[model samples]
Target: MKSNYFFRSIHAMRGLASFAVLISHSLTLYPFFEFRAAAAGVDIFFVISGIVMCLAIEEDTSKLDFIKKRIIRVVPLYWIATGLSVAYIYARYPHMSHSWDWIIRSFLFLPQQPGVDMPILYTGWSLNYEMFFYLILFLSLFIFKNAPIAAACIVAMIASFSAVGNLISYNYFFKQIFIEFSLGILIGYFLKFGGRVEKNLGIFLIFLALVIFFIHNKFASSGFLAWGVPSAMLILGAISFENSELFKRNFVKIFGDASYSLYLVHPLVIWGIEWYVLPEHRGILQVAIAIAISIFISIIFYKWVEKPLMRFLSKNL
Candidate 1:
């Protein structure tokens, strides 16, 4: 398929989203620096997932093939990151108690006990929601051919889960957060078939998104209301402005391609910096340097490990 301006914008946004999360997580190293606002990165990711699913589904491909492709795209890199986390855990706390069941559940991305809902690699929690969304999307294809209808079903299911979330399993998929994914799917459908808006309106939406992002960071509202709405606004605005010159940059697109690698490997980079490189120096400058290194390393990983493995698997499997 030909790459459109919207897809290009989406690609660039992926890198921005990954960096946002990296900044937010850096708060762990420098608590004095307020980076909590960047946590909205996760919300951006959920929305992207929804939109990409709509864009990517091909009637020519079998549902099983689609599912397999999704798994191969995400799981291998995720497993490597999880392995790193496990090795770190073993080295850091040799006597730390860990359950075999939890480890299995972590590796499989299954929901475990509340306290340990996250995997050995805590970031894998997001992947659980991702996989769940993929499963639901895959199955929904059998029942609904229209992407919009399937998206609506996903929204309704998440809404129902949210209403009864307190009574049901506290798995990540059941949380209100999953609604972000549904919103993204709806947005995807809009991009595919929705009417065009005036460019001024697109600019307004972008401004609105920024305003909401800043406000949410300062006030700290519910994740869905705060980051979710802003993320949707950003995507909608970006789509609306897809034909603009702003979407034509190659650097952003390259970063977007490396976004997954950046997201997955960043934590390890942070860990190394914090635990070994400069344990005593977590000042803003150190954090900045660490973030720089993480980005550089992630680009390398993307260029080498991620790209090569994906190509190999796509060709062979």
Candidate 2:
């Protein structure tokens, strides 16, 4: 089946964002890389999740079915990665205490102690937020006639809470990060009904969004204020190019398809390099090799494991 160019653009951006996260962590070996802004990849992810949720879920789809499909999409690969992380931690630090509660919480997508965020897989921390947003979106389906209003309501609720200084007050629900999701929903609303801009105007909006991105980096520390809005604008701008030639590239679409695999599996790639490859060849060479190997392995893993499993589960579940 042919892929939608709009979604293809979104997915391609996802691949790029995932790569930014890989680079952000990998470049820690070189302090001169100066890519701290790449950490905003997570912000981009949250925005994408918010947007995709509103775009993908159908109006006729039941809430339970929606939740089940989300679980099928997210949980299986996550569990595999978490189990590997737990095993590695055990082998590496057998003397350290292993909290079953933490492991269970990680599996359940619950936040760890001190009311801060920690998951056994470490990167699974973002999955916690994803699951939280999914739950909210699922419930909203029961109460609202369409996904857009539900998304808008979510944004309004978070914005109001933020105004009252109650953001992040209700544990994880009212977090500042949720604002990104809200922004994404608003963008999704526009994409669903707002129609397209002229090609020149779209190009200008994209340029303006880039300017906002750099300005946010200069002035803002908060991810929501910094990268989130710019990320939303980028998505909006990218959608405007759905009918253009650039979005038709097959390589970009394939990279986007492998993005979820890259996101879930790159930590293992990093762990492998740190343990085996880095001690002997620890430099720019290793960084380059790590990136190449990570992407290669993620693509293979996606084709062999994630794609087949998701297809099976989608049919059976």
**For this target, which candidate reaches the highest TM-score against the unseen true structure?**
1
Q: Which ten residues in a row have the lowest lDDT in candidate 1?
A: 1-10
Error of 1 at 133 (Å): 0.2
* Per-residue lDDT of model 1, residues 1-317, tens digit only: 22541476677678889999888776677777555668888889999988888767656647777888899899999998888888887887799896888888888989887776578887788888888888888777787767435755766577556666366656356567788887877776666665555678888988999998888777767658888888888877776666667668777777898899888988887787777755566677767866898889998999999999999998999
- Could you tell me every candidate's TM-score relative to the true structure? 0.92, 0.89
List where candidate 2 sits over 4 angstroms from the true fold: 1-6, 159-170, 218-220, 277-281
Go through the candidates in order and give the C-alpha RMSD of each one to the true structure. Answer: 2.2, 2.8
Give the deviation of candidate 1 from the true structure as CA RMSD: 2.2
Indicate which candidate wins on lDDT: 1
Model 2: ten consecutive residues of lowest lDDT: 1-10
Candidate 2 residue-wise lDDT, 1-317, digit = tens? 11341466677779878888888777754444566667777888888887777677666777788889899999999998889888888987899998898899898998787654678777888888788788878878877887656765775586456555643545555556677887887676666665565667767777987887777656646646667777777776776676666666877776788888888888877776777764545788777766888889989989999999999999987
